[model samples]
Target: MVTNGTYERGDLFDPNCGTRLILDRIGDKWTALAVLRLQHGPLRFTELRDGIGSVAPKVLTQTLRRLERDGLLTREVFAEVPPRVVYDLTPMGRSLIGPLTAVSDWAEEHINAITTAQGQYDAGS
Candidate 1:
């Protein structure tokens, strides 16, 4: 339920909860990178693609479309000789940055340990 624009938190543990869908969206690698790339400001398609490195054009387009559909970002098109489109984060999207940054920090801190564990597990298998 929502009251005056604030949502009553959903039970994420519930099997039928919509929160899991959101979790899936935010948990994607491309989503994370795209959000991080747009943190500074909006960018055109090519600019975002370049900033995100090797993601294929189709993959990035799909990711951006998903983000737009989820209301996490906005896509604007401008009419010109060649046309222009820009992607910018919404307020809700900007809110994700801090949490994502924390997760990123945790990953950076534990990556070596994680890789070591993976190597050990692979060797045992």
Candidate 2:
């Protein structure tokens, strides 16, 4: 439903809704981390890899490609001696920071309780 080029709100509860795919992308651990890492500014491939911890080079490349395809981020290549490339978040991607931050904070706040619950459940099994 488009009214004068503006799309109406999507119904996420609908199985066919594309919003679920967007949700899945944002819910991904790598995606969330990558987005958070770019919150400060752009970073090079190696920098992103190091900042993201244990992500493999191949995996990171794929993730970056997917993010680029989804319009969440941009990858720019510079014509340098060694050919430098940088990744930066787009406006849409920056919008995710607040929501991701909230989720991250909630996880940090409840991790101990979650661990305790998991342990209790395991012991009872």
* lDDT of candidate 1 over 1-125, digit per residue (tens): 44587556778897666677789999999999999999999999999999999999999999999999989999999998699999999999999999999999999999999999999999999
Candidate 1 stretches with Cα past 4 Å from truth are: 1-8
lDDT to native, each model: 0.93, 0.93
- Candidate number with greatest TM-score: 2
What is candidate 2's CA lDDT for residue 13?
Answer: 90
Among all candidates shown, the one with the greatest lDDT? 1
What's the CA RMSD for each of the models? 2.5, 2.1
- Which stretches of model 2 miss by more than 4 angstroms? 1-8
Per-model TM-score, in order, reads: 0.88, 0.91
Tens digits of per-residue lDDT for model 2 on 40-113? 99999999999999998999899899999999999999999899999999999999999999999999999999
